[model samples]
Target: METGPISAILDTTLAIIFTWVGYKTAAIVWKYTPYSYPNARINAMEAKLLSEQRFNELAESRTLQNFVVNLEDTDYRDYLTGISTYNVEEIERSLERALAGTYELMIKILPGRVSPFFRLMLEEWDVRNVTSVVKAKFRGEPASDYVMEIGPMLPKVKAMAEAKSPEEMLVILEGTPYEGPYQRLLLGEISIQEFETELYRMHYGKLLSYALSKKNDERVILEEFVRLRIDRTNILTVLRAKAAGMDSEKIKSLVIPGGSVKLDPLIHVEDLSMALAELDSTRYGKVIRDVREEVEKDLSVLERALDKYILERMGELTRFYPLSVATPLGYILKREREIRKLRAIAKLIEDGVEPERIKELVGDVA
Candidate 1:
């Protein structure tokens, strides 16, 4: 068995040759196979064909049945959950959580590459919550404790800083990112009107800026929504000021400059209450129409009427734009509606109001 060095080298070369031959044969077989890299064009065509067929099938089945099937197949079970017979407090809590879940899903599904217009609404909600908490803290009211944590402005810090009067709070906010409105607050000088104007300006300015930055259909919808809301807000502001016996000039000063109702006509009137009626006759005539008797009795009724009117308009918008930013905006509205309904229900139920009455006062079932 003792082999010479040349013989051993020859054996090794033969082994190497056989290994290379086997590899080459395997490569040739693989190349000629149906599902191999060399047949990549066919594979790609087949994949495309399959995808088209599936898409056609989906298109054909795009009905309630398919929707139900998709819901069953996905993590959408909770969306279908309903509150039928729960007590008022329980129903309120459940709806709040559901609304929160809706927003969470919205934030999840919104594309990372989306324009900022789609996010303007959520931004407004955040700012509103933060500003409310700040104002409440300055008033030394308990409302500060209920601030939602998701607001853009740091509420806790702002609340702590605004623990003094609103004037002091405005000074505290100076030189920060929110300083512009704070400066305007000092100049506009609505001491008797309170700083509600400043808050409105700050929040709406943020929304307006965000909306203007985008140039598309989404931006159009969002901007319209903001404009409508601001108009309604100005109406409420004027009505409230008139009811409170504030002078016409002061009330006009509080009006946001670009709203539907002009301050020029409003400032000319001597009687603030009469001015409010004239203003309503022209602009918000419809909302105050049915409540005219109530307004004559007490202007406070007009404020509630305006609130309901605003909600109705917002509800319509929600219906119109379900798949857009309007959906999440609807969630916020729904949550607020639930909270108000619960508060109303709690007070009425304690008064022994019938369940039927409770339901009627709140709304129809979803």
Candidate 2:
């Protein structure tokens, strides 16, 4: 068997290709190594998240005191410790503080480059703070009592609260990410709902933009979740506006971008029922259809159904992207769900509603 220089050159070329491939594989492996520590911490925190059964247990408590006592064995205990009355306001405040603590802890423990993802996500809280401030100002009340300390807009919270009118608030809000929403507010004849709608679009639009820019697993996880949120928010806005008899053009203007489906048709629906009917063709159609009858009876039930659907989707998809943004976002959403459930349970028990009925409302939505 005789071989020429061509055969030798071919062998050398193959060797070089294999070496390059090996180096790339190693680089990919090293890129994910930093996720190991934060992933383990997220894993530990996830184990502490309340299960469906635990939510049922919390629901079965006949009194707020019993409900508070039931929470003693969970991670929430630290947040609720030494609270004597366990009043609803006290309980809600404590739950909010606990959520803020979780956000701060996640931000600190996450890899520095990826930490900004969670921080951007937390801006929803700041938007909420602004919502309360502007609404209170419009109503001639102070918002300091209602403001919750959960997001990065803390430096401007005082200014936001001190502003006596929309113009003053707009001045305080100048030169911020939130500036545009108030700028829109300055345009005459905007309802409170419309004002909040702009905030939703700005917040989710920022999140989806940043997620897409990542072009990695963070994009894969956060982008899909953000789009889901946008769709949910848009759908609710349309239905509520239709129910309130708002103008179709105004309703259309409030719709946010980034949904997987076209939501513009929803704005033109003749009524609330018709709006829900319009959803019959979207990705969310099935979830909406499944509860349409109940939704007609109680619109709050529609919110519960949609929240459960997005969460279920997140739970299903995020498993593939673990050790990235998936774990932290999933953990925070699940924690928020638990607090909502607990709040419902406490409020209903105080209202003298039966435990079964409470569970029916706040427990697993089919």
Candidate 3:
């Protein structure tokens, strides 16, 4: 295909036009999307609320009963009403609708430049759906009741229609991507603990590979962030298992392959005290600082501590990288925070918790 003079000129002109359009589109996005200032303010607020002392206190307490510590706003009332009204069917419908709208938005904004960011955002949603399905399968939940139908994967409601046992689940999921993990667990070749550990590793490992495949600069940072989050999760998981009387062999089998957890230190930790000491020796030492007291007294404290830790960490990252993938990620975190706040307020209002107690729970409620 030899290009004539006119054809060459037209091709060159179209190329220039497309390049300019792409540049202008990206410039507009860059200008409007830098919510770093607001993010920073929120991060500061989080730091104040989740100070080291506060974190230690949360870790020491079993109940997040303080979730609504401070309350004066009717906003919480509406939020609670909304949450209370959402039945399982309603939540599934809403999640599907939200995912469809988000995917449409992603397709529109994802020029060559933003494809990586779009995918990074989608990864979180993917994990949510996968985790939901896997758990649903374990509990013999119905597909419509379990799977959120908004992703690249084909809908498999029929496949899981009569799955009431793990063995039944394996037969149903035989050819699906989830089959391998489900089978590994169902066959007794692998424990549920190992299945959970490996499944998450596979998800994040795929995510990291996807990020690197994009060959983008900011994505490198996002990948590191993903890795760090996974490490924290694994650490929390190990801590909980130790509390549950899991042998070191089981703990080792369940630890995700990658990240800062060295096999030797992990193997040496026999009890909660030893586990905390070993954890203190790792890079996450700062993350689990002074958490032993809580681990010693109540295991539920670890859940609160982990939640507070991730919230604080994500809040900080949202501030640091406002316009990039972190902004949307932060928004997701904010939405979660809002949901929890709603739940807390609703529980408080329903239980008629004293205003003073509510104040202590949510902390200077608005």
Candidate 4:
């Protein structure tokens, strides 16, 4: 045999071995990782929760009292029963407590390595708490009761909660991820709404950075999910801004970058129809097209459609990739939506909102 042929054969064999080893190592790492995800159980639970019967039962609830009674047999019974009163405000607070408790439980059950993702997800709660505190501080009202206790940012939230003034809160936020948003607020560079939007932008930026650093199949899935989320968010922002009659520049400023959908055309559109037309060629085109009639009925319809789209996609991912991060993440997202649906139903019931209207607001089962 020629020496060149022999060398080529050996090189090819070594390459195959290395590739096999790399794949095996990755699989082992994923399987043995510290996440401790209860993937199968969570997926099963999600399936049960979204079943048609369960959704109809929830949608047909006649009153907040009735809803609470119906929840007696579900995991939410305790949380709903914890409400001291049937008033909207009390019900809302109890719902927050329930959400916080759920997050805390998730954090406790998940491994430390995987906990960061949940913690990051919980940062929205932290942001809401902080916003409440800052507003209350400015208005000279008590806010400590509004601070949530279920995120990696809890310690900072607590400190900010204690701050006597917005200025003090800003000082506390210094050197943190939130500092820039607060600084912009302090300098009159952005409105309160803009500040909140910026905070969300920052949160998603961090999430994207974390996903990219993983450099694995899980990361690819997560990045796609995050990008879709960003795109939906941008679309909603555009629609809302148009409804509010915001100037083009302001609307453009609110559009977050890095979404899979190109937003440039939509952002500059003079009207909602124009924006929808721009979205006609994107991956989400069909979603917006299907909801166009509903959108004409009320712009809020897009919000509901976007949410449904995201959940549907997540459900698909979980079903196809049961062993991946998709399972647990999909469960978490669906669970959160369930909680929101319950809260909305309770609030609507308290307000004597019609069952049909409430059903519309709650949207599809998931």
- Using TM-score as the measure, the top candidate is 2
User: What are the per-model C-alpha RMSD values against the true structure?
Assistant: 18.5, 2.8, 9.4, 4.3
The lDDT of model 4 is: 0.74
Give the residue spans of candidate 2 off by over 4 A: 1-11, 82-85, 163-168, 183-189, 364-366
Better of 1 and 4 by TM-score: 4
Per residue, candidate 3 scores C-alpha lDDT tens digits across 232-326 of 67777677777788888777777775564665675557777787788777766665675667567875555556556655665676566555555
Encode model 1's per-residue lDDT on 1-366: one tens digit a residue.
667988989999999999999999996554333223312432232232213223233233323234224333322336334534435444344444444554554455543323344354445444455456555664678754545444445454456444556566665566655556545545764442345565567667777766666555446556666666777677667666665667776776577654556656656665555666676656577777777776766765666676566566656765664444444444445445444543454545555666566556545211
Q: Write model 4 residue lDDT over 161-187, tens digit each, in one string.
A: 787777888888888888888888888
lDDT of 2 by residue, 268-303 (tens): 767888888888988888988888998877777788
Q: How many residue pairs clash in each candidate?
A: 0, 0, 12, 0
Question: How does each model score on TM-score?
Answer: 0.55, 0.88, 0.62, 0.83
Candidate 4 local lDDT, residue 273:
79
Global lDDT of each candidate: 0.53, 0.80, 0.56, 0.74
Assess candidate 2 and give its lDDT.
0.80
Estimate candidate 3's alpha-carbon lDDT, on a 0 to 1 scale: 0.56
- Model 4 lDDT-worst window of ten: 32-41
Better of 1 and 2 by TM-score: 2
Off by over 4 Å in 4: 1-37, 47-51, 58-61, 100-113, 136-149, 155-162, 354-366
